[model samples]
Target: MSELTPLDKAEAAAKEAATDTVAVQLALAAVELAKAATAQQPAHSPACSHQHKPGRSTGEWLAIGCAVCVGGVGIAFASIAIAIGGISVAILAVVLRSLWRDYQRDVQKGR
Candidate 1:
């Protein structure tokens, strides 16, 4: 049997990591949904033991907030890029616009 190349190993590791991340995110969503459902119930409800509190420390909460902010920004940019076709096209448009402006300025300076 042939040994796996370094790139192959890295790709396999990345796939595994992505799977694990999805699983963890699903689990966290399930927990949050459960908590929200339970919170809506009466205080005397039999299932209100409060054992499912996935409370995070201040730093952890701050980290989550930062992650959410970054993710939101990324999604916004991705949506814009998709709406205008590929990101490469959008980037090229911006670069060309800048170059055009620079060329116009240089032409004016030469006159």
Candidate 2:
């Protein structure tokens, strides 16, 4: 998955807002709000649909972070060890889950 940093998010938000119609903008904003409320997250980043496009999931992100940290500490302590192999596959699982969940949620919401 492409890494989405604050800079990338801000740029995308600006670009999307520039072209959005009034109703589309409001709907997108509402979706963002709903997502934030569902996650019980603060408005760290602005709620933009572009940022919510088909992407990774929490599990995949957790796994990747764990693997990276493990690899770093392991290499530092021992000679070398790649315990977490198939990084791409694991990450793909997250992407698939995120897409399917979003689709299901949309269907339930009658969107």
TM value for model 2: 0.24
lDDT of each: 0.91, 0.83
Compared with the true structure, what per-residue lDDT tens digits does model 2 show for residues 1-81? 589999999999988987686988888899999988879865476756465567789999999999999998878766433
RMSD of each: 31.2, 38.6
Candidate 1 deviant stretches above 4 angstroms: 1-54, 86-111
Candidate 1 backbone clash number? 0
Task: Report the lDDT of model 1 for residue 65.
Answer: 97
For 29-104, candidate 1 gives per-residue lDDT tens digits of 9999999999997877575556787778999999999999999999999999788788688899999999999999
Clashing pairs in 1: none
